[model samples]
Target: MDSLSYLNKYFLRYKKKLALGVLFILISNIAQVFIPIFLREGIDGIQQEVQYDKLFEYGLLIFVAAIIAGVFRFLIRQTIIVVSREIEYDLRQDFWAHIQKLSHRYFQNNSTGNIMAHATNDISAVRMYVGPAVMYSIDTVSKFIIIIAIMITISPLLTFYTLIPLPFLSYFVYQLSKKIHKKFTLIQESFSDLTTRAQENFAGIRVIKSYVREDGEIKNFTEQSEDYLNKTMDKVKIQALFQPILYTIAGLSVIIVVWAGGGMVIENLLTLGDISAFVIFLGMLIWPMIAFGWILNIIQQASASMKRLIKILHEELEIQDSKATRTIINSIKGRIEFKNVSFRYKNDLPDILDNISFSIEPGETIAIIGKTGSGKTTLLNLIPRLFDATNGDVLIDGYKIKEIPLKILRQNVGLVPQETFLFSDTLKNNILYGTKNGNDELVNHVAKISQLDKDVEGFPKGYETMLGERGITLSGGQKQRSCLARALAIDPKILILDDSFSSVDTNTEEEILKQLKEYMKDRTSIIVSHRISTVKDADKILVLHNGRIQEQGNHDELVSLGGIYADLHFKQLLEEELKELS
Candidate 1:
């Protein structure tokens, strides 16, 4: 659907509040329209030598009308304007919720800064249009209808002359609104670029400083900011012409009324009170004319912004919960199998894994060892369905992995990636993040199993230490160990560690593995590592070579076979002996 149609759906949800606001506006205009009538009466009454008490009564009625108009005007804003804010809130919330449901591939292709711009600037623009623009447009049209009828009744010729410039004004507004919409779309695009550039600079500030390239980054950012400014100024120039042109049209109408109505009154064709009341009615049209131009500007900007938001909101979910998929709410046994699985990052790209078949029993521990690009990590990712295999099937407990509900499947599997990420929160909070209701006992248990407890004892605040962005406050090994503790705290039935011990010393790695052995009873564990010591004791070891499994067996059996696993083991043994000699 188009942007306007999409927004209308949200507007209709709060139509009751909007209708009440319009009613209040109509009542206020009616009250205001009576004031001019009373003024004409007071003047004619004085000219006819009416009683002082009667004139006082007309004056009193005028005051009452003004009060009623003011009160209803307040009510109009209270209802309609408040509803706009409520709709803005709902739109923002829904936008964020949709963003969260998007897959990892979506995030990989879109920048964080660009998404943030939609949430902030684009959403705010749409809100302004829905709120004030809508309110003022209704106010302007309703008041114009009532006041024009009254003016024509006072003097038809004068009213006809006053409306001559309105058609020209409408033509000008139509032409300019189209230009404004085009320029506003460009401006929003520029703003997104500026946001993306700024976010990149901030995130890579350390790299800039380390390489002494701060000046270069600043220059690039300045150029981006200037482009945004130029785009804004272009839109501003178009908007600046709008109000002045509207005022000129309105000014011409007033001039016509004064010139023609003055002659009528002098010739006794119209009374002094009648001419005075006609001008008062003409004055009411000024705001409506100006609002005509202003609302158009609002509409153009909102259209551009809503177009951008709709692009995201209407995006198809590439990975979704299938209707035929089973809902497994209970804990799943971690029996995993890969049948002739093959995967590529993109269809045109070369396969990262090809014709791979493997299986692990429910309580078995398996390890994957490979060169840097041999698909070790890709094979592990299939278990959690991070990216589905391009061909063939992945099964868990005799059922297709897709058959299990995503929430239940993920909850039972804990994965600690090579590149660890921790929130800028207390250490205790980070560990307990996966296990939302975890107590101290569970935290400590996982900490010891991951060998993270020893490091916490040296911290100033112990488990309460506040980490910096991405856990910058911790050392590399500390980050990895803490992440392990977090994953283990969830008590997952299937734990996958992808090079999780790369930063830790062999002694520490051995200690963590020993503790993990006890934790692995009745649970399946998949370890992806380069060090022979890390995976030498696994029940099965699979050596991957060039997108294919080269060998798979117990470590001793592979060593006896003198294959890729044997070669890796011998090379690692030489490196360790050299390290000891040094």
Candidate 2:
């Protein structure tokens, strides 16, 4: 949607408060207009020998009008400013929801630090523009128009003389606002870079310390901080220029009004009251002129921020889901097939997987064995549609995976990625991550199979132990087992253990694999492992080399064939024996 249209929706949501704010500005300015008239009337009343009682009544009326306007001013703020905060709340929420709906590729390309800045700082800037900035801009413009018309009506000659410096004020404000906007954009970008640098250091602090690079990191951070400082100074210097310039112009207007109107009053061409009203009107115009510059600054900053947000919000979804998908079968038989699939992360790069074909029957165990950088994880990722293949289709139960609803497709497919992440919560909560309501039965079943039950019980808090972040964290092996338990708790039709046991002890691995064997009997299981012993018993095994299938068969059949898979199995077997002897 267009940015203005998007902003207008927010306007409509809080229109009542905005209307009330404008009413206050109108009432306040109008009440101010009467002050000069009251002073003029009092002067004329005294000059014409008016009665004391009559003059007292006129003064009382003036005082009552001021009080009434003050009440309106109070109402405006009470109603409007609070609504501004409410609009802020809504905008923040919608912005977050939009980000969540974006595909995983978006997060891959954008850093968390950059996204965080947009959600917090940038959005707050937009909110300010919407609320106070919006109200005051309209208020200033309306008041300027009202005051100028009133001054002209009182005496065109006096008005014309006073407004000679107005055009210069506009020109100065325009140029200054443009410069301020450019500097502000630079400042925001610098902040993003600084945040990214700080976050990276924090995440890899152990490596930094181990490598004795603390001084280097601090130096890099200092450079980033310095750059941010320079950008902020630039913004402040430019934006500050206008405030003093605007105030000077206001002072000039006052000087001109006094000089010209003093001559008219002395010449008897204007009343003392008329000249008084003119000076008051000029005084009133001062605030709006200053606000005009401030409003221009706000608009420029908000426009720059909105453009940055648009770039992300309008980004294309790399993987599209089907709209005409129906419910999946209650119990999937777990047959998977890949037909002549070719895939690449970018169009400019060479294909990562080229024309690969594979099929696995129901309730069968298949091991995908490959070395690092051999497209092992890439192939597995395609099953759950982390990315769409460039060519051909992947099917489960004779239905194209892309045609099925993502919710249904993912419900049946369980994946344990290499990096195991757990939220900052209790161990039991982590184990039951997506399985709402804390399913103890399912949690305990998976924990036992993953051999995490023993590990969890060893903790003082047992299953209820708080883990993650800097809390009472577990070892790498324990964490992996907890992740495995999480995946298993989902009770998926197709279970994929992707290097899930790499960090565990040999005895623990043996026990987990043995338990997984029984679970795999009536389900489709795909295991990716570097250890030969982990995959030697699979019904079928495939060896992948540089994005292509090099060998495929049962472990014994492949060993007899003496290809890549056979060589790897024999090498691992010899290595194990050597270690035992030592």
Candidate 3:
């Protein structure tokens, strides 16, 4: 659907207010038209040496008309402008809510700054057109129609002369509208680029400082700013010509009316009072004409902004439940299976997991050990359906995950990724991020199991301590533990820890694992780690190499087999011995 159709629905939601606003505009314009009639009577009375009381009455009538017009104008703004603000609020909130539901892949393709521009600049532009532009456009048209009808009754020939130049103005404005829309669209695109550059620089400021590339980044940013300025100037150039052309045509119309009407007055074809009122009415028409040009500019800019917003809103949701697969399971058994699953992020990319298969029964602890690029983390992500396999099926409790509702499947699974993310909120809030109804007892229990309780004890406010952006105030191990506590707070049936313990010391790791074993007794646990010690005691160990499972067994069995798992264990043992000798 077009922007107009979408906006029409929003407008209809406030139809009563809009109708009232239009009525007030009509009243205001009618009152304004009466002012010219009062001027005509007052001039004719003064010419005839009329009594002072007669002139006073004419003056009073004009004053009353002006006051009524002003009051109605105020009402028009209160109704229409307020409704536009309400619609803008609804649109922006819905935009943000829709953005939150989009998949991780969507974010991977679109930058944060680009999306932010849509919410801020684009929304603001749309509001400008919807509110003031719409209000004034209606006001202008109503005023123009009223004044033109009055002038025609006074003298059709004079009115025709005044209106002859209007068709030219209309043609010029139509041409300018198209140009303005194109230029404005380009300007918005350049603005997006500028915003993206600034956002990247701010987010990567630490990297810039570490690499001593601050000057280079600033230079690059300046170049982007220059490009934005140039595009803005281009748009300004088009707009600069708009008003002058409109005024020129309006001026020609006035000149024609004055010259032709003056001759009529001299030849006794028209009275001086009639010509006086006609000029006043013609003068009133100029504002509406000029306002029409301004309205067109606003509309063109809004159209460009709306088009961008609609593009993102219309994007296909790549990761949503199908119509027939909206089951909300009451409980999850935590049994997981990868049935010959092969996967890649994109069709052209190499398969991260090739024809891989594995199964973990409920209440089993499975450790996955693999090299850096062996799809260890990717495999864990599939369990929660963060990304679906390109081929084959991943099932939980003998049911394909795609058939299960996303909320039900994800709610039962807890994932602690290697790259932990913590919001800039209190430690307590971060720990209970994904859970509902987080109580003190649950928070403390999960923190203790994740070895975060001891750290919280030393904090200034315990669990209430506020964190900096991405939890920058906390150490790496503390952040990881905090995230682990968060996942545990949800009381998930399936827990997948993807190198979650890398930052903690071995003693702390052992302490956490000791507590976790009891937690895993009734839940399914999958640990992906590079450290052999981290997963040595798991019920089953699967060693992956180059996107395929190289071996699978208990620690002692894998050691006896003398494969990749055995080789990794022996190497880690040698490293520990060397460290001891040192």
Candidate 4:
């Protein structure tokens, strides 16, 4: 019950429609109860042979009342169920949006499949409880109470015998609820594993096929499926055992009513019409009882699912908007500065970047060069405030980066990451995706700069050609070029390219740098690369070693010093020359 408090708020939101559904059930049940009285009157009237037209009139009135009750029943479902669907829609959107707000750490801790299960299966289970299960449970209980009261008014002795098994059924339902909730939770978790496996396999299908592990994949799926199947069987077995017990007690009550009530009729203690009405009341009670068991199943499932969803909503947001601090400046001049900053993804582990301090003037190109894992990309990521530093501050002009609104700051900063990701859409759409208002001319200009114009020309449909997932249709170099075009389309004030030209050859890379220089004057640009050729002509070169700036100079100054920067430049030159000789 404590686990279900969050769901109760949504229930309250749709309480109006629920009240209407209950009202309709009340009207329907009243009409149904009247039929027993009408039947008794017609029976007694026919036997007495007094007023034949009166019986026909009474019967006609009964039929019309029943018809009207049926009409209200349809109206109840239409109104209340639609309202429930609205709740479902709202819940799913919030759930998805919350998932997006959660930290990257959450993704590292939880499986993709588990998160997906909460969105799809868990939400669906809650929907069933919200709409159908809630309406039916209310309808079932209300009808039983009203009908039973009417029966008691007619004959308390008959009601007593019929209700003897109800206490046992109540206890049975309570016990079943505890067990059902536990089992359903297990079943849902098993399904989460299964869904995760499917998602993982689909996303990594290339690896599986290349390795020829089709049989291995099948066996893994089968094991997950078996666990899910067993959980379901456990649920069914409990249902199979309990449903009969509920009905058997209900059946005994009916048999008891006939044996006891029929003898009363013979002894002149009850009449035939009274006995008939009592039997109708008993019959009315059975559907509600049977439905009670079904409702329990829904309630337990919904409870489990609702709690699972709330777990996500309850997570503390990692990247929260600073409420205590307001922006000191409205706009920035794009002068980027990094103070003595130190950062590590892990608390105990050594720093990925340590005591790094550098500044780029308003309109200059500064290239970073390092070996792999030397914090070249990490340094670029810090400027956009993707992950906040453990110490020190990054300032744009005079304003701290954190003080700027994320939206405004990111709009001014464009990053082309090491791994290129593209949508499965036309090449034109992917190229012009940086800014919403990007024009054809802007896209083509960037495409020429990245040397992607030739790749687009080779395609049968030119720029309109559709690429596969992650731009699988394009070669690695072409994909990077397309990604470069995307960032360039934004026309950002500060551009950060983190080893983006890794896949492109020297000639194409040279052409890209040449065109980029013309288009991106007066705006700050940071290039991160290992090849000294890429950053040699820059205003300044930053050489990072184990997350610290070991050298900073122009190409000539760094070469003269003969430190880490000079050594790396010579090593790269040697490698290129050796490759040519070989």
What TM-score does candidate 3 reach? 0.91
Minimum summed lDDT over a 10-residue window in model 2 is located at 322-331
Q: What would the per-residue lDDT of candidate 3 be over residues 231-299, giving only the tens digit for each residue? A: 889889988998898788878877887799989989988877888887778778776766676677778
lDDT of 3 at 189: 82
lDDT of each: 0.88, 0.81, 0.87, 0.83
Better of 2 and 4 by TM-score: 2
Better structure of 2 and 3 per TM-score: 3
| Candidate 2 similarity to native, TM-score | 0.90
lDDT of 2 by residue, 333-352 (tens): 68899898888888898888
Distance from true position, residue 275, model 2, in Å?
3.2
Residue 467 lDDT in model 3? 91
**lDDT (Cα, 0-100) at 427 in candidate 2:** 84
* Candidate 4, residue 323: lDDT: 61
Candidates' RMSD to native: 2.8, 2.9, 2.8, 3.2
Q: How many pairs of residues collide in each model? A: 0, 0, 0, 0
Model 4: residues with Cα > 4 Å off, grouped in runs: 2-19, 44-62, 170-192, 221-243, 293-304, 324-330, 346-350, 469-472
Alpha carbon lDDT at 316, candidate 4: 83
